[model samples]
Target: MHTDARVLNNQSLIEGDICIIGAGAAGISIALDWMNTSKKVILLEGGGFEYDDKVQDLYKGKTTGQKYFPLKASRLHYFGGTTGHWAGMCSPFDEVDFRKREWVPGSGWPISKKDLDPYYAKANETLKLGPYNYEFDYWRKELKDLNPFPLDDKVIRNKMWQYSQAHFGDLYKEAIVEAKNIHLYTYANVVDILAGEGVQHISSVIVKNHEGKTHTVKAKHFILACGAIQNARMLLASNSQAPRGLGNDHDLVGRYFMEHLEIASSELWLFRPFPTNLYSWEYGVTRASAELAITEEIQEKERILNGTASLLPLSVGKHQKPRMETWQDEDPRKSSESLFKNWSEADEAAKSEKGAIERAFQLNTRIEQAPNPNSRVTLMAEKDELGVPRVNLHWELTALDKRSVRRIHQLIGQQFGIAGLGRVKLMDFLRDEDDDTFPDSTNGGWHHMGTTRMSDDPGKGVVNADCRVHGISNLFVAGSACYTTSAAPNPTLTLVALSLRLSDHIKRII
Candidate 1:
């Protein structure tokens, strides 16, 4: 039931019970749930099964405010989406990430962690993960000689991470093609969403492909499972009915963007060799990494955002160079190969000097940036091959983001001093309390989130608790775009879980 949209007749109307756009992790997960069901599901992908430079160039645009990766290189526009090159790091959002914090602006989700608990377990199966466990003690019992740093729980605790090798395009392609009730259309890019009377319901979606073919997809329900940036861009671009864009009356469609502040902030010089395999990266099996995180109690006292710092061997970290500078190729595969080569060389160099290395490591910070409305994705004047406006990203970081990183390391340094673990040398940028500017080395996890944030109040968010667009009945938005707050962990797990939850809601209604 899978076909290339270019092969279909131009201006043909393809009707279905449900239409899910962007066959990425979220879109594929949702489509799988409806397999063999009576509902006729149509899934759309912008690109073919593999990478195409022409399609990737559609993602290129201007980046203002904070320096960022080239928009074209930041994301992959293939069937699997960005998961094609994902590092497989996965973790659920903490409970505190859902609750409102006075310090973080536009923080809090309408639903709590408990609400997504069942779906997270279901998402684990979809992700081909080991188990639904993230506890440090659980991993400690499973892993031999696995021990944590001697630190107070009130001050610092271990944050667990799990890895998944499932590439959605490769793993689920056969199943998707074989599904009787599901029809997947590759190279079908949704250029506009045609709205019905009063812009309350979707009539159909205008789709185009590079082959110069255009068609229409009509469905009872529509779910935008495209990644954060494209989801916002599409909503902002479909301005035929609502004028300001469909369901964009509040001017909140592409606002409140958030990303995890990933930076190598400091060095941890331990007094003795820390022989533990728990934190090291492992594949094909479940493992947990220890990250020094400040407790929720301390966060309330200090009024700072949530953050975690993981340790890496100094020998390995010192050799690790920035890839953005040299990775100028437009094709993601070439860039990925270059990055892998660099990491391989660095790993070899680190191993060669391993015997002479002292008890020292590097501290890397992964922190949540407070939601700022100014940080957004707006439509650029330049149009892509499909004649749709490209996205212009204005990624903004707050002073609180800088302060939190400095404070977290300072607190960790103090605890290390008290426990006699060793001494911590703060990075030059963090040493200056008055310096609010981030260094060029300061980068994000490349995790895009929070543009179409969910909220109970229509005035605040593009979608509601059910992920349905505000004032729109049959339209829903899936993926990290609906995330209210981007947690320190990667957004894949939580976003897939939320997609499953949305699927359940759709089933209940239909």
Candidate 2:
């Protein structure tokens, strides 16, 4: 059953077996798994069915350390959460992403990719995606024309990505509303978490809405399924009991903030026309596209971080500019429309100049940043309408991140030179070795991760392998906030897989 928290009386108490805060992809996915089960689940969403200006204002905060999108505009606060505007690109984390790399500080996950393989397959169904096969060879067999770049496997190999069009809210709303065991409460913004004696167990959560109604949700187990930034924000803001916030005894609640550095870094001038069908975007159907990724052998030899480079024809890439206006808007639907319009214009222009186009193409980089302790999200003194402190983001990038991008392009250019296939012109910022500062064109994927990072050691991470918050048995964290490393692909697929894994653990425990 679905209800609005605003309509409930003040100081009312709602009880459930399991309470999930934030009805995003993670929260909704978990709740769906519990449908028709014996468990009584309560899912809390901060906003209504659609976007609201007042609720969005709660996300407004300050940003420093790096030029970032306005805090208010980074994520949506509706029933579907950020998935409302997601493009649905899905790929699993590489095996190397889970291993411990000597060059990457604070790297490695307590659980390996193998641990989540079964769950990833299950997640594909929930995401409304095609087969879970990400192998280039598998896609080549399915699509006859899907040929990979003729590069040495030891030096560079092709990586695949699948697409999905499922918007959780629109696609699963009916099922969720009709589920007898699951209760979804909209406009139920979580303001605080009340802890029991000894600060070991969570007694209940304080929720409020703009209508001036307040209530307490009491559950045996509490899971924070909010996004990375907000997950840490709520933990930091709930300072009534633990002082440093619940499960934040080690001061590791919001540190090690990571983002995939998505930037157009160079231009590749090829000798011949590359097959557009293999690399260009495809809709509705699941297809594989090749991105030049360095092999693990080379990463070990050079001691560089993981990264991938994608090619785009110069004709289409030159017209592409940073959509700041779209990103700064509170409503994500506007951003999605703007993105589609921009892509359509570029596609039309590319087709008109098909024959007259040059051999040149743009090289885009999607590189992972090494986990740094200094990069974090802290609470600001200013409070929002709910009297909760707003967040101040300190997004810091390291020299290694820049070095990795430059090195990947350099290696790609060298291979092209040897094959007599193309020549690459490095971007101005990358040309100078001394200038480590990234250009204004450099932007993040807006994929927040690694805030409440997982580690077996309590001193190192906020949560353990099972996503249970250290020192707090009844409280757990969900979503990318528990990611130990941000891999090259988008985090949605892996995050949903992780959520499914967490759900199983909760079921086993409860």
Candidate 3:
């Protein structure tokens, strides 16, 4: 059954077996996993079905260090969450992302990729994606006439990406509302997480709405599946009972924030027309496509982070603007409109060379930033109308992050030249070997990750391998926020898979 918390009586006492906070991809995925189960699942969404500027304002905050999207417009607060407008790119994290790399500080996950293989298959169904296979060979067999570049496998490889069209709100709204076990509360925003004795277990949560109504939700277990920034804000803001906030005794609740740096890195000028559909993709029509990437062997040799380079027509790419600049509107709707308009215009400009890929291609680099503890989300002094602390994002990049991007392209360029594909012209910002600073136009992937990172050691991370809070017994986190290291592909697929794994663990206990 679905209920609007705003309509519930003030100080209402809602009860459930499990309370899953935030109705985004992660939260909704976990809730869906419990549809026919015996346990009563309480799913809380801060906003209703549609976007409201009032609720959006609750996400408003400041950004420092690196340039970023407006916090208010960066994510959607409605029932669907940010998936309402997410680009459907989906790929699993590389195995190296789980291993500890000595060169990258704060790297490695407590859980290995092998632990998530089964969960990833289940998540593929939830996301409405094709086979769980991410290998280019698998896709090449399934599709027709898709020949790959003859690059040495030891150095560079083609990374495959599958698209997911499943928007949670639209795809699962009916099932969620009709489910007898699910108690979805829209307009219910969690403001505080109360703890039991010793601050070792979650007692209940305090939720408030814009209508001045406050309610208490009591559950045996509490899972925070909100976005990374919001998840960190809630943990940092609920510090009344626990002076340093629950699960943050080690002063590591909101640190090591990371994002995929998506920037125009270089131009791959191929020799003559290399007629192949390997690197091109039409968003809605294509099921899967491949991008240039470095192998783990090469990454280990060069000590660089994993990243992928997608091809764009030179005409459209050179004319395109950085997403940071185009997505500046404080309202997500306006910001989305501006962004799509720019993409549509670029598509129109690139139509001139549709039949002929004959010459130059722009390589847009999407790489993970080294986990910098200094880059983090902290509690803002100003509170929202709901009396919850807003988020302050300090997005900082490391020297390793910069060098990794340059090195990735340089490796790809070398491989291309060796194969006599063509020479690669590095962009101005990448040419300077001594300069560590990025241009003002450098764009971020809008993928928020790693605030409440996972680890086995309490001193190093907030959550354990099972995603439970280090010290808190019944409190857990399910989302990209638990990521110990961000990988090359987008976080949506891996986060959903991780949520499923957490759901299975919760099932065993309950």
Q: Candidate 1's residue-wise lDDT over 272-334, tens digit each? A: 777756656655654556678899898889888899998778898888876544455666677
Give the per-residue lDDT digits (tens) of candidate 2, residues 48-68: 998898998898888888677
Give a tens-digit lDDT track for model 3, residues 80-185.
8999999889999989999999998889898999999999999999999998999888888899978788888889888999898888989989999999999999
Model 1 ranges with Cα > 4 A deviation: 283-286, 326-328
lDDT of 3 at 412: 90
Question: Per model, how many backbone clashes are there?
Answer: 0, 0, 0
For model 3, the stretches where C-alpha displacement exceeds 4 angstroms are: 352-358
Which window of ten consecutive residues has the lowest lDDT sum in model 2? 323-332
Deviation in Å, model 3, residue 428 alpha carbon: 0.3
The most accurate candidate by TM-score is 3
Q: Could you tell me the TM-score of candidate 3?
A: 0.98
Flag the better candidate by TM-score, 2 or 3: 3
| Root mean square deviation (Cα) for candidate 1 | 1.3
The deviation in Å at residue 112 for candidate 3 is 0.6
